[model samples]
Target: MAPTTERASIFDPDALERVRRELRLHPQQLRVVRNAYFKTFASEQETLALFPAPERVHLDPLPLHQRLDSTLDGASKLLFRTSSGLLTEAVVLRPRSGRSSLCVSSQVGCAAACRFCATGTMGIARGLSVPEVLGQVVAAGQLLAREQRRLRNVVFMGMGEPFHNEANVSEAVARLIDPSYFNLSPGKVMVSSVGVTDGMLRFGERFPRVGLALSLHSVRPDVREQLIPLAKRYPLDELRKTVRELNVMQGRPVMLEYLMLAGLTDTDEDLRALLAWTDGLDVHVNLIPYNPIDAAPELVGSSPEVCRVFAAALKEHGRKTTVRRSLGRDIEAACGQLVKAHTLSERRAPRSDTSSA
Candidate 1:
């Protein structure tokens, strides 16, 4: 547990207000500090310099446990240590377009237990507090700002099923788009889930402008259940309706995320079922190439050619589709992969450093 008198997170306005009153500082001073750190992503000293008695007003921060940059691509993975000693991750994707994006985790480990995900294998842990989630954006944004690049997008697609940790993730996202904080457009942030129906619907209603991505790895009920064990509870039929409802609520195409696993999810029937399920909903189908994880060696990614054919089929059926390019292949690019390997090696390095990757 944290100290009894824990500092307010830099993102927590209420806590900051209390701190300001206690310090007997002007309201504008608080604003300046917020704008400096949250908006500008300034260094610790630079931000603290703008405040009076900076040491007294504690801005809860997450430690940078480690940094992993992929040699093959513009991808960087950041591992942060929670006060609890458990590690969580955030990944930064820098495309050539110069608009960089950050992928933040909502939980330390995942409860959904998707068979293909490494985080799931670890079972459920505590949901990340708003600070932990937003710290990733602040830190990643600072990293990008130094490179003279803009942090254009933030996606909750890192370590866990987002909807499983809905409350904290929701608060973190609100501050991200709030002008007083990160000041990002709601459109630039995305929340991806493995079909947590109630939480998914609640998110759509709360943040209509923010994009939602459903990890529909398979449309077939049996296959989905096998791949995402949570499917057994939520079921595929309910998920389809939820997507349609999300469309009506948001007035935008919900993003359908499909991971292409060779024989498991990339077959003629799978394509047909997907087309059938999304026949009327407003959704952009994103076919993703699988990243191999040691936890699930049985799950082989579909070939590039097979993925292309799948995309072509979706387009032929008049569905909006894009084959998401795999970024950060060299540095255990999959979420939780680096941390899992590092944790095992700590007990079992020869550290598996990604700089040389």
Candidate 2:
């Protein structure tokens, strides 16, 4: 819990307004502070310099604890620490296309327990607050601003199942696209889910322009259940129906995220099932290469040739498909690999007590 005298989060406009009223500063002064902080993504010091009473405002509620840059690609993993010492991760992806993107987490850990996901192995600690979620964008945006590049996209594809934290995630999205806040285009924001049917419907209805991706790794009921334990609760048929509804609600093709596991989800039978399942649905298929993780030793990614062949087969069937370029493999920031190893190690370390006498 925050202390009584804790500074107000810059993400909370109400709190900032209250602070402004208390300080008796001109309204334009607060607007300048907001423009510098949210729009320009200025450094905390620089943003605070614009305000008369900097001591009363807190720029970042979640302080960045560590950052790891990938040696093989334009990807950087940022580890942030909450006030309670819990850790969450966000990834900055600078693909060759030059449209930089940020993947932010909604929870410290994940409860989905997907067999192949490292974060899923760690039971969820807690859902992030709205401020915590938006702070990631602020931090990442400032980092990109330093490099003279703006963050073009934000995806809820980092460490946790987004629908599980729907309320906070939804509130964060509201502020992200709100004209007076982050002011990003709704089309550039996406929330990926593991088939939370009700939440998906609600989210689609609320933010019709925002992209929604379903983690439909497998259409086979048994196989899907094995890969994603949450599948058992929301059956494949139900998920397909929800996707159809989302298509109509959003008036856009829903993204179906398919993970390619060699000999598991890449076989001829699996492809046929996928084709049959998506026969008439207006959806785009994204083929994601499986990133190897120690927790799931049996799951290996399909070969490049196999992925190409799979994509070719999809295109031949009139299905829109694109093989996603997996980034940050060397830094363990790729898909299914965002478990905070440092946080786990810290948890295992013995602590010493030095109480003042």
Candidate 3:
């Protein structure tokens, strides 16, 4: 009896028939041939680069808003959309000097739920995708360049939890750092997290050269948790430990973001806790006054006197600190304010129609 001959299928049916005919394979051998050909073709496809050809569909060269208008027919002005699905909806604030920066969203709505933050009230929706995350930078870059400006920096203090969305956020960072794409230096980017230890650790490993900011509103555990619910899950002690590890790993000082709320979490005790937690660590404290929101009327911005006292205490402890002046206040560009207004306006519209009818 003759031994069975192994046959393989060529991926192209016509090619397979030609080869089979040329080889004059037996009927059984043809079945074996077909299978082998498909297996090899599938393997080759897997290794091939899948990104769309750069020339076929170019991202419009026009500015961000213009592209947006062209895409959406100028209906929706780029305001804060819910941060969960899109991660964050942002307005590309056209810079006065043509120098712009992106206010990127870390999470959809913040889980922090800080007393003064509208985003917090909305709660965490979802994390943004890598492309969605990078899209914000691309949008800002287009808008800025239209006005003869360029993006100088990127702030990840927008609507979402950056640390929570670490994977996508890191991917987006990788894209930004790519020269063919945004080509942004790691130094020009800043990521703010509400002190999630696991996320922080991973972020440090993924982006060792990027800037990190801890949203350290109140160093006291109880007060901190009250201001940010996530604080309950990750206490100050744990957070401090994480920050120390991150600092050592990155070999750079981390930024401490302290939001001063009037009469709340701004006492001498708060200052002492902050100093203690940050003691012997390389860090810079950025004091940001509470951006007022209607959702929490009780929360108010800290006065200059209170901010000064805290700054002095931090200085006394030999910790570096700087006060952040509020920008875009008039345009509702302050953190959470734009989203809050959008939410309020949306709610009022239905009520107004009902009353009119």
* Top lDDT model: 2
Q: Is 1 or 3 the stronger prediction by TM-score?
A: 1
Worst 10 residues of 1 by lDDT: 348-357
Best by TM-score: 2
**336-355 in candidate 3: lDDT tens per residue?**
55555555565556522211
Model 2: residues with Cα > 4 Å off, grouped in runs: 1-7, 335-338, 350-357
User: Model 2, residue 32: what's the lDDT?
Assistant: 92
Error of 3 at 88 (Å): 3.4
- Model 1 residue runs over 4 Å out of place are 1-8, 346-357
TM-score of 2: 0.94
- Candidates ranked, most accurate by TM-score first: 2, 1, 3
lDDT of candidate 2 over 1-357, digit per residue (tens): 223444667877788877777777898998898889888999889999998888989887468877888988889988887666777889999988889999999988889899988888876557888888998999899999999999999999988888889899999999889888889999999999999999999999999999999999999999999999999999999998999999899999999999999999999999999999998899999999988888889999999999999999999999999999888988888653544576677689863232110
RMSD after CA superposition, every candidate: 3.6, 4.0, 12.5
Q: Report the CA-based lDDT of candidate 2 relative to the real structure.
A: 0.88
Reference-based lDDT, each prediction? 0.86, 0.88, 0.63
How well is each residue in 180-294 modelled by candidate 1, as lDDT tens digits?
8889999999999888989999999999999999999998988999998889999888999999999999999999999999998999988898999999989999999999888
Q: What C-alpha lDDT, on a 0 to 100 scale, does residue 290 get in candidate 3?
A: 66
